[model samples]
Target: MSMLSVLTSFAKRDFALAYRQRAELMQPLMFFVMVITLFPLAIGPSPEILQRVSGAVVWVAAILSLLLGMERMFRDDFMDGTLEQYTLSTTPLYAIVLVKVAVHWVVHIVPLLVLSPLLALFLNMSLPMYVALIATLLLGTPVISLIGAIGVALTVGLQRSGVLVALLLIPLFIPLLIFATSAIDSASLQLPYGFQLGIMAALALFTLAAAPAAIAYSLRVSQN
Candidate 1:
């Protein structure tokens, strides 16, 4: 098969497997919603306060939700020998990693995006705030998946690498979190957030270009 065919096949297989494990897949979405729900309860139903902090709340929930699913990204493949097969295949590992991360990002982030409107309503966000939130998420969530893939690949062989992955990844995520929240905050005040959005898009592009190679290297080293 051609490289595009191989990439598509791998992505479809991963999506099928993810569907079969739908319960596991829903955990992140559940956690994301519950966190957003709890914030109002904990902080009281003040529109002013909720709107003020909603961007940070959403961004944090997204990061944690993405983290919750990161472990499964490579664990099943590693255990079932699929990861090693990818390593040995004539197809470039970079393409394989790209497909895997893309599928993983779609599976995990789409639900969060679907739920964001409800979250915005609950938080009493302004229209601008909502748009900015969605924009940041669109550009940022994939970065989470790409960067998280590297951490997951690094620790795929370890029995309990969740904590290590979090440790390695959360720091990397701080800059994204800051940028996302800052954009939303600026939007809440009716200021231009295009600068922050551009920075986030640049970060996402850089990750898109660099992370596949890093993930492929990590997977190979872990398997050896």
Candidate 2:
């Protein structure tokens, strides 16, 4: 089969398996909603304050929500020998790794993306802020998965690597979080947010180019 076919099949398989574990798949989305919902109660429902902090709230919640599932990104595949089989296959490991990250992103991030508008509503975000927020998320969340995949791959075999993965990833995720929230903040002021958006796009592209090889290598080293 061609590489495209292999990637598509692998993504579908992973997605199907993730769907079978419906409760686990729901955790990140639930966390994302709860955090967004609870923020106003904790901070009080002042529209002015909500508008000012909305971007930061969404971006922070997104990072934490994605982290909730990072541990599972490669653990099942590694534990069941699926990862070993892929590593040994003639297919390029980078393509396989990319597909795996993409699957995880879709499974974990899509629900959050769908619910973001409601969160925006809860935060009383302006239309422009909402637009920029969605734009950043569209460009940012996959980058999180792509970069987080490397950390997850590195620790997949460990007894308890969840916190370790978070530590390894939070620093790597800072630039993205900054760019994303900055874009939304700019939008709130009727300013052009394209610069921040462009930077985020560039970061996403860079991660796409670099992360698959890194993840593949990390997986190999971790399995050693």
Candidate 3:
């Protein structure tokens, strides 16, 4: 089969499994909403206070949502023999990983980006910063998803590895957090925002180039 055909096949299987496990899948989205709601409560009813903190709140909520959503992505396939077959197939494992990462980002991260504005309102985010927030998400979120795929690949079979995965990823995510927050902050300050946006774009590009290869190497090492 052609490379495109193999990726198409993998994409179908991935989405099919996600559909069958809809409730489990929705947990992350639900968690994001719930967490955002809790922020206002914990920080008191002052709108100013909430507004001051909303950018970080939305970003944290997003990270948590991705964490909730990633565990089953690689774990299920690895346990059920599908991943083994893929590794043994003629199709490049890195290509297969790339496809799965794309599909995972679609199902998991896209919703977070879409719903961010709504979440931002609850945290009292200012209206002016909305475009910067959305732009940051659009330019930066694929890196989050790709980094997540690496975490999933590394910890797929381990018992109680979620903490480990978080530990592994949080440092890597710091640059993302910095630039993402900076973009929104720039908009709030009425300073230039595109520079931060450009940084995020660069990171996303790097992740796209590197993640698939990293996942492929990890799978090979694991299989050995």
Candidate 4:
């Protein structure tokens, strides 16, 4: 089979597996909603306050939710020995890593994106802010997935590596969180946020170019 066929097969297999494990897949989305909902109760339902912090609150929830699901990105395949086969296969490991991460980002992030507008209303976000939030997430979430995949790949062989993966990744994610929130914050103020969005786009492009190879290497090292 050709490389394209191999990668497409990998994508289909992962998507089917994700469908079979729907409950496990929904955990992150539930966590994301819970986090956003709790903020109002904790902070006493002030529109100004909620609007001011909405970006940070949503971005933080998103990062945490993504991390909650990151551990399983490779563990299932690792345990089933499928990951080992991929590493040993003639099809390139980086391509497999890219497909896996792309599917994961879709499976986890799309639900969150769908729910974001409602959550934005819950947080008293203006239309401009909501638009910025979507823009930032579109550009930023993949960077989170790509970078988070590296941490997950490195720790997948270990028992109970969830905390370790978060510890390793949270610091890396801070820059993304800052840029995303800053973009939303600027929108709230009726200011242009292209600078912040530009930085996020650059980060996404850099990670997209660099992360697959790094994750492929990490998986090989972890499985050794």
Candidate 5:
């Protein structure tokens, strides 16, 4: 089969599986909304305070939510021997890994993106900051998925890997969190945030280029 055909086949399978297990799929998004919702109650309802810390709160919650779902990225495939078949297939493992991560990101993050407007309003984020928040999330969340895939690949063989995945990946995510929140903060001040957004874009591009191969290698090692 052509590479495009193979990738499309894999994507469809994943989406179908995600649809069947949608309750599990929605966990991350629900956690994201709950975390963002609790922030106002904990810190009081002052618009100034919410707006001031909104970027940090939202980005942090996003990272944690993504991590909550990261463990299962490769677990099912590994358990069912699909990963071993991929390793032995003529099609490259990296291509399969890329498709899996892309599907996971789409299945999980799209809901968060859709719900972001209401969450932003709840936090009293100004229009400029809200736009910047979306921009940063668009650029940064893929990087989170791509990099998190490597950690998940490494630990897919472990019975309890959720905490391990978080431990391994959260430090790497800190830089992204900083750049994203900084962009939002700049927008709040009515200043340009092109630089922070640029850095996030660069990180996204770099991970998109590099992470698939790293994840493929980790999967191969884990399957051995």
Candidate 6:
């Protein structure tokens, strides 16, 4: 079978998991909405305040939402003994994980991108800034999702794994968070955000190349 065919089947498994646990998929979406709604209450109703904080808030929410949903990418399969089966399958385990990670990004991160504009309004962001934020998210979030999958896969079957996962991920996530929020901040100043997007897009590409083999190796070692 072609790599595309194997990837499709693995991605379908992700979709099936999404279908079965509808609420799990909803958690990140709900978290985003709830977090955006709370900003006004906590910080008062100033447009300036909202504008000042919105970029960081959006990235923060994006990161947390990804964190919340990451475990589902592999932990359920690990629990059901399917992860081992995947390791033993004819297709390369890393290739299988690569597809699942991509699907996981679609499940968790894409909705965050779709909903970013709505959240941006609560921050009192202007149309230009809102557009920039959305653009940065489109270019940047795949890195977060892919890197977070590595953290998730590392601790997939461990008890009380939350703290460790965050620890593992924070170093990787910092660069993305910084540059993404910087892009939105640049938009606020009416500066060119294109440079930041370039940096973010590069970061995404780098993680795409590196994370799968790292995760595949981790899972294989865990099984030993």
The lDDT leader among the candidates is 4
Per-residue lDDT for 83-148 in model 5, tens only? 888899888999999999999999988999999999999999999999999999999999999999
Q: Alpha-carbon error at 192 in model 6, in Å?
A: 0.6
Weakest 10 consecutive residues of candidate 3 by summed lDDT: 215-224
Order of quality (lDDT): 4, 5, 1, 2, 6, 3
TM-score of each: 0.99, 0.98, 0.94, 0.99, 0.99, 0.95
Clashes of each: 0, 0, 0, 0, 0, 0
> Considering summed lDDT, which 10 consecutive residues are worst modelled in model 1?
1-10
Prediction RMSDs, each to the true structure: 0.7, 0.9, 1.4, 0.7, 0.7, 1.3
Per-residue lDDT of candidate 1, residues 141-194 (tens digit): 999999999999999999999999999999999999999999999999999999
lDDT of each: 0.93, 0.90, 0.82, 0.95, 0.94, 0.83
* Candidate 2 clashing pairs, residues 3+ apart or interchain: none
Which portions of model 3 show Cα errors greater than 4 Å? none
> Candidate 6 on 149-216: residue-level lDDT in tens?
77887777688787888888888788888888898888999999888899988888888899899999
Q: What's the residue-level lDDT of 46 in candidate 2?
A: 96
Minimal lDDT window, size 10, model 2: 1-10
Choose 1 or 2, whichever is better by lDDT. Answer: 1
**What is the TM-score of candidate 6?**
0.95
lDDT score, residue 4, model 5?
A: 97
